[model samples]
Target: MLMVTLLSIACCCGCPAYFGKPMWEQYPATASLPAQVADLSLRTDARSENTIRELRTDVQNAHLLADDTFAGVYATRQGKTATVFGTTGFHLTPESDAEDELTRLTSKYDLGEQQVVETDVRGEHQRCAVGRSDGVDVVVCTWADHGSLASGVFTRLSLADSATLLGTLRKHIVSRD
Candidate 1:
């Protein structure tokens, strides 16, 4: 019995402690699932220029930018990268900050690190967080839905790209003003 207990403990603490397919498998891509917010457009705002510039630089520097029609940004830094979704208006409402919300959601999943990096996406504000499993990092970005607007938009990047982009984002990106 003692041996079994010790073995169980060791096993639990072993690398990749839990047995399961990679996160990509669990959260299958919904590529074919029509765009949920394809028709939404951001409310126009002057502050959006700064937001877009920051997001563009970050995505470009990290090299994770994808050519999507939605006019969002994606980038990788220090082996980490993330995707951002913004409407034409470029504003993320107060309710759309999912960083805080994700911290709570991840708690139930045994994922680690609920630290969220809050920033403005284009003119749309956004929240980001990093989660780790089996020593791999998972980064998620969500755009908060403003009043009368949708709740928010979310996207994620693989651990490798996430780490790289996160590294670059932290070193090169600033959210002042």
Candidate 2:
């Protein structure tokens, strides 16, 4: 049932219509997080209403993916032999508790201090952090300027698609910034 719901959600917006049809298969290797040190970002407070308004308009320029599962829209960038993933926040009711848990776990992991920075998106403030586990690189960022919402995207650079995504994200951020 959960799979059905997820699939249904994945088949909407700009996602490939074929994603919901037959022959739907995910690459096994890409199905899970890579063997790397996982890093998480810090918790953020809500943004001002003006900031939210600005972010809403600015985010439209982001490089949005058609089949993104985390956020209906996401922006990608290239990283050091890896990829950087960016997306709109997940603010489901349950996600509130989840964010708190993530914050605690992130502190325990000593993933470095969460650095608050202004995102390329207007008015959005991002708390960015990076960590690694095994051989894979992990980055966790939360954009909380969009009200009671947070956007986060996890990325692995080992996959070819990830590499491509990283490059795109890098290009967009660098040029836009």
Candidate 3:
């Protein structure tokens, strides 16, 4: 009787131990922090009213994705097209160097080819470039004045629409003094 009880206990314990090994093996831990910190960080803000006003009017359903001290992203959708307009204020960095950083950040998207263009923004020479993605187009505009550098990107719109939208957005960007 004693031997039979011991065997039964061992069998019950053995079954769980056997099953646990496969469970652990199937779901191995592989989580690690990113090696490099991204210069751009975005979040969804549903209650914020501090983003670009023109961007909200351009699309049917507009929402603010992020609102940081130096950057912001506004997401919108029209028909089947999804778009994102991002702006970054590089006041802490040198104006001359902000263009390179903004370029690097925008390059993460699938911009096929790039071309420079003139924008309606009030600046002697603002850096405005347009590129085409898979089926969407993107426009990036950068300007420097006084000690501040500002850059904006409008993505996933038609070439004409992107250009038009950027022009409207540029009007609202207050140049640094």
Measured against the true structure, the TM-scores of the candidates, in listed sequence, are 0.27, 0.29, 0.38
Give the C-alpha lDDT of model 3.
0.41
lDDT of 3 by residue, 1-177 (tens): 999999998899987776454333322112111212122223345532344334444321321222222334544433222233433222222334335534553554444443344543222124546654455556665543223334556565554555455444433433222
Task: Quantify how close model 2 is to the true structure by its C-alpha RMSD in Å.
Answer: 18.6
lDDT of 2 by residue, 1-177 (tens): 999888778776437554322112111111111223222212222442343344434333342321121122232233333222223332223223234423643753345555554435433334546655444455555433222223333455323333234333333332110
For model 1, how does the per-residue alpha-carbon lDDT over 43-85 read when each residue is reduced to its tens digit?
A: 3344544655665454344323222112233332332223332
Stretches of model 1 off by over 4 angstroms after superposition:
1-97, 108-123, 133-135, 147-177
What TM-score does model 1 achieve against the real structure?
0.27
Candidate 1: lDDT over CA atoms? Answer: 0.34
TM-score between model 3 and native: 0.38
lDDT of each: 0.34, 0.35, 0.41
If candidate 3 were superposed on the true structure by all CA atoms, what would the RMSD be?
20.8
> lDDT value for candidate 2?
0.35
lDDT comparison, 1 vs 3, better candidate: 3
Residue pair clashes in candidate 3: none
lDDT measured at residue 10 in model 3 versus the true structure, 0 to 100 = 84
Off by over 4 Å in 3: 1-69, 76-102, 110-113, 119-124, 128-137, 175-177
